[model samples]
Target: MTRIQSHPVLGNTSERLRVPFYFDENLYEGYESETIAAALLANGVRMLRVHEESGTPRGLYCNIGHCMECRVTVNGESSVRACLTTIENNMKIYSGQQLPNPVKRMVEQE
Candidate 1:
């Protein structure tokens, strides 16, 4: 794992509850205190989602929940920010995909 072993403020990753979560149907381990983006990045898994319009790859950006770049689906909940959500045992996380353009579709139908 590429996690920070020690930090000036957070200190070290003291013993925390190890939780298992599924991402894109693959199993991965994380800590309960970590957000989805942090856990996935620590596990060496980036590219959280693809651009809905262009299908370009996207990852954690402005992790404070403003840019919406780290969006993911959790336990069937859509558009959940990975940077703000805490990990949970047995949680099902699915990467966001390029969704159809609703506005474009409406114009096409007309």
Candidate 2:
């Protein structure tokens, strides 16, 4: 993965903190100031998740959070937008088919 040390418009990103995160059990380094998608892309991880229905491979699309193509399970939470979620230290990210009702549960009645 290559990082732009200097840019004409954005300038240098060297000042950003290099935080360690995990993607499917593998360790990788990324800047804490950027989103999870950006960090994954920087690490050459393009395949975020597969299509839940057809089982086709998918990656980042319409990176402004308008598309759900970049959904990834972040730290036990499924169907999280990689483009919208920021990279946190030691984050456990997973890429696979989206699980149904991952955050929902039936309440027990008294």
Candidate 3:
């Protein structure tokens, strides 16, 4: 189920190799060098993260990097724009983790 078992356009998506990673404390299997958003989407992770203002869920709105709707925090960096970032082995992504302490303090201070 980790690999693309079925697809309309790119039938039976093939990958170079499978790699393990964590997203917000959840372990996920994906291929190396693939976009994190692509791997998440392939595994039915529709909501990458939420908007700060409206709390609206968002995902790969654009496959390319232009839309910025698929923003996520990879390894503590916020607003990573997932569609543009490729997945790496043992990548500890923080898509749904609580905001960083500094950012939380900054927000509270504001």
Global Cα RMSD, each model: 2.1, 6.1, 4.6
| lDDT by residue (tens digit), candidate 2, 1-110 | 66777778856778667899999999989886778998899899989998876678899989999979998889999889999999999999999774454334343321
Q: What is the C-alpha lDDT of each candidate?
A: 0.91, 0.85, 0.74
For model 3, residues 1-110, the per-residue Cα lDDT tens digits are 45556568655446367778778788888776678988887677888877665566766787788987877878878788778788988888875433346666789999
By TM-score, how accurate is candidate 3?
Answer: 0.73
lDDT of 1 by residue, 1-110 (tens): 78887788755776567899999999998876899999999999889999989899999989999999999999999999999999999999999999899999999999
C-alpha-based local distance difference test score of model 1:
0.91
For candidate 1, report its TM-score: 0.86
- Return the top candidate by lDDT: 1
Which portions of model 2 show Cα errors greater than 4 Å? 8-11, 98-110
Off by over 4 Å in 3: 2-15, 96-110
Structural similarity to truth (TM-score) of each candidate:
0.86, 0.82, 0.73
Clashing pairs in 1: none
Each model's backbone clash number? 0, 0, 0
